[model samples]
Target: MTTTFGATSTTDEVLQGVDLSGKRVLVTGVSAGLGVETARTLAAHGAKVVGAARDLAKAERATSEARAGAANGGSLELIELDLASLKSVRACADALVADGRPFDVVIANAGVMRTPFGHTEDGFETQFGTNHLGHFVFVNRIASLIAPGGRLVNVSSAGHRYSDVDLDDPNFERTPYEPMVSYGRSKTANILFAVEFDRRHKSRGVRATALHPGGIPTELARHMEPGEIERMLEQINAQAATEGQPPFQWKTVSQGSATSVWAAFVGQADEVGGRYCENCHVSSVTDGTIGIISEGVRRYALDPEHAKALWAKSEEMVGERF
Candidate 1:
């Protein structure tokens, strides 16, 4: 079904000839990077986009080019959202619900990366709290605003293979906090959130899925120590050399975000629902922590029982049941 799209495909390339004139979409993290590119391309193709960002001023500046280029009755509206804070997430969700606008898709695209040991405003671990729990409560609270036959696209990562959710210590109270470890837990949680969410909402034709936007150099790595990213690329390239695979080639923001829009609007609903996707297609369940870097969803990331457990844990942490 996605024969024409692959790792190198850009958002504009994937959405070519596809009309989105009447669609309304919600995209979080629109202050920069793939989020802005995703919103831009969608609006250029004629969808109304509600762009949410923790810093509205930053978002407005970033989206200036997008607003100027929009066509086909497309438009963009900025909204304030801070995923790390439940109060902010809830306030945003309540505002959207009050507006009574139905979204064709809700893209929980905002997240933090390997931050140093810290806690959110709610005292939860920064990575897990911001990347997973924050979106968890935010999406669940606004679940009804998604129109039937809609989609929820969680921007996850291949980093999930680094670790699985530690339900007992989601906040890393006992476990030693390494940035990637926490990031992995949070990313894995993203996939599992989609797994359970799809099961709960697919019957109503609203399907949930997660995707790994291939390795890209984005502001998401703002938390990394200086030169840490360069070290990572060297390591990845070294690994690829041993495996006879191509070395790392950074994806442009457009290419990285293609899979997100593809999964949200083009991929087959039944095939992608509750599944993890990458490279513009349904990812194979590799079922393990591979040695070298590569593509594939980890088996643990899609486990149904684990998904259910995470849902319970998230509800407990957020103090809200969906």
Candidate 2:
């Protein structure tokens, strides 16, 4: 077993002594929460960080906050990117490519949870469309700009444990869309996307990994009802109330961002592609005591056949290839 960093591990803890000098990292959803923390930590470690967000104003604010928190070698740049729109993703990629600056890490940390039933401008369900399909196209379009040994960290969630992929009705066209199920499908897609991406690109010096950032009290909860949030916490506490139980808990933004930053800059993950990570470590594949995964890849998430099929279907939907 590898060193296990718990959900309390801070971003700086995971990145301690991991110098990213001269590395270029693009971090999406940097307007707040774990994304902002991840970007800040990377920048602090000497990476040239590009912060992507839907709103320029919010992006600027995030950059300012990061700068105020910068240590040695900290640098940040803001860029416009709305994952909800394929056109926006393409344009952002084009801009970066045209600039001739290569990225060493692309952290797909931005996502929406439990969005109402709707479709992207490209006509796909909101969660599957924005969270998975948008990122699908983004990664492919920007593949050339990702340098050898580069990392692509898809920031999935433990909520993925809730469900698996629905191949027949991925877009909910044939079936009614339930928010949680749609979110689960998209999260599952995030991991599979990494698995297939690594298979295709690892030899080219690019690697992809997916991560569950652990539960955090982040902006992600803004969409949930207050009662729902209370219920969620009550449920967690209820589980922890058992004798000899470790406390069921939530992470702060820094803690939640740790695994992602670790995947990006830690040497342990180098040459190790397509693994699912959490709590600043590679998560265990087995069902464990109290059902908490300590650290290996989930079999279902790593199913290569499913990944390939999803890739083809995604390309058909996006109207392009890597």
Candidate 3:
């Protein structure tokens, strides 16, 4: 039976009665925010979690706290990964491959939000590079290492409604870059990646899903300027007005991670695979009248043709085949 876990459901609440012993999970951006709660709660449920971060020192300290909160024989380890650097992404993937320990789930949870124009070390736009391409390459390299019936969860955002991927100029070579637009494109890519990945790998017993972890005030918003924040709030409030709904409310860290954790371990593979989830369930496709932080996936974000096209363009950009 499907349980309707809501916006306020905490990680522990969603995971109650779940036993993760012998489950191997990988979580990115575990140094802080939702990543920490995700890793910690899974570990608490007895999953062995490999927490990836750009800074080993910071991750070490963070995982120590995660370890303290773990129950049912849960534990966490640190791995170095700088998604803004393709070289680092490869290195981290290589390290995991060499370890040869198959994963039960891989959570592509690391991402940057609205940021000023900049390029990654690989010369892609910062948000797209780090959020989508980085995870793209990482997942391609490690796809074979996920155990049968395993999952790949990409932590996307509701912002995907803001824009769709412009395959011709994803890096803004021809168009002007707007921080939120770029972030939206990246998020859209995240969902498409999961869609295509599931199509290609489901026969091999690996399922892929993407999700919006709810609106939580976290470090991911550190890049937003005050004016940008104000503008975004205005947009959200305006959208809410038209929808005849209340303004959005921010979730706590544990609540923010509930959907992701549920996607990873709670639902049936066929039920969750290739779907964009929020509030711990598969979201319906809706028009943009929904508030910025509201629950729903956009039709464009789940288009099969778009998913396949993105897979091809991503292969060209990363210079690797999956």
Per-candidate TM equals: 0.97, 0.92, 0.97
Q: After superposition, how far is residue 27 of candidate 3 from its true place, in Å?
A: 0.4
lDDT of 2: 0.81
lDDT of 2 at 95: 86
**Model 1 regions lying over 4 Å from their true place:** 1-3, 288-293
TM-score-based ranking: 1, 3, 2
lDDT winner between 2 and 3, please give it.
3
Per-residue lDDT for 118-229 in model 2, tens only?
9888888999998999889887888888898788999987666656788778889888778887888899899999989988888988899999888777777676776997
Q: Candidate 3 residues 1-322, lDDT tens each?
A: 6566888999999999889999999999999899999999999999999999998898888678788887777788888999999999999999999989999999999999999999999999999999999999999899989988999999999989989999999999999999989999999999999999999999989999999998898999998877876777888888887778788777999999999999999877999999999998899998856456667899999999999999999999999988
Alpha carbon RMSD to native, model 3: 1.3
Q: Which window of 10 residues has the lowest lDDT sum in candidate 1? A: 287-296
Choose 2 or 3, whichever is better by TM-score: 3
TM-score of 3: 0.97
Per-model CA lDDT versus the true structure:
0.92, 0.81, 0.92
Worst 10 residues of 3 by lDDT: 287-296
Could you give candidate 1's per-residue lDDT for residues 70-124 as a string of tens digits? 8999999899999889999999999898999899999999999999999999999
Between prediction 1 and prediction 2, the one with superior TM-score is 1
